[model samples]
Target: MYKAACLVLALFAVALAVPSTYDTEHVWKAGNLSYVVPDNAVLGGFDPYGFNTYVGRVIYANSILPARVVVETGVAYFNTETLSSKLLVYDILVAERNVNYVWVRSFDGFYEKGAVAVGTTNKNERVFCCRAKTDGGVLIGTLLLSQKLCIIKHETLALRKFDKYEVLVAQAKGNGTLY
Candidate 1:
């Protein structure tokens, strides 16, 4: 009887040591970019360095990007939970048009790459979507353009895709964004 009681105590202790899936103070932020999981949403594991991407569903995403750009991708549903609108596959999407490169950070520390096609606009912003894989599935999204500049003057620039394991640490150091 004493051995069983001790085992229960050990199990309880381990449970307490594990991090909670929901944290009110857990906010993913990077360089004028920030994201907060909604109270009704369940947040999965997030990256520790650079743009910490997190997977979850928001009741309503109120412009998480810079310059108040609002986007609604689709419904986010978990195992048995009811579907919620605004499924945020990746928490943050960064595109540097000057270098003609696109970088996306996922909730589980995974990254995706894609090329940016120069858009036909006054600002000359690139109009393209980035796709990244997550534990759940593939996430397709686009980035908001901040400015328009024709530095390269090219229609489309080829972007090098990196494997999730290969660019894990390098992405944190601000490398592998451009080809």
Candidate 2:
């Protein structure tokens, strides 16, 4: 009886030690640019780093009212350039391993599929979604990887198609998103 009780206690402790990926403290990543949704008037703000800049570090999403995300045909994009939409809400449809299927709430209070587009640019680069059905394929949080988080794929988390630019979920350093 003591052994069984001890085992249950041990298992409970281990489970508590596991961190949840749904934690909003972690920011989104695409290539070298950390997606930092600011808590300002801008709906969707860009990183201080230029589109071609690589800061070589993780930038947190430090906003209480970050820009709302819109997913069209599995591709994700921001509704506006500012972060003031009360209708913008996100929910994790499913969580697997260290990854999760992130769903964005719609204007009608419905969640839609969110995804990343790879190689949208003719140069075989760029992670953001621009055109539809280009060489730059759409990636989804619904897609799972069998290997390490490298090489952004049709269902990957990284930003670029290839190279060292990997998409990953970055945890904030204390000063992160409230939600």
Give the winner by TM-score.
Answer: 2
List the pairs of residues colliding in candidate 1: 53-107, 54-107, 123-148
Model 1 over residues 28-132: C-alpha lDDT tens digits?
A: 222112344333221222221212232332222222211111223222321101111233343322322333222334332222343332121222323222334
What range of 10 consecutive residues in model 1 has the weakest lDDT sum? 147-156
Instruction: Report the C-alpha displacement of residue 40, candidate 2, in angstroms.
Output: 7.9
TM-score of 2: 0.23
The TM-score measured for candidate 1 stands at 0.22
| Weakest 10 consecutive residues of candidate 2 by summed lDDT | 50-59
> What lDDT tens digits, residue by residue, belong to model 2 across residues 73-159?
212322112111222233211123343322232221111133332211112222221211112332221111222122222222223
- Models 1 onward score TM values of 0.22, 0.23
- Best-performing candidate as measured by lDDT: 1
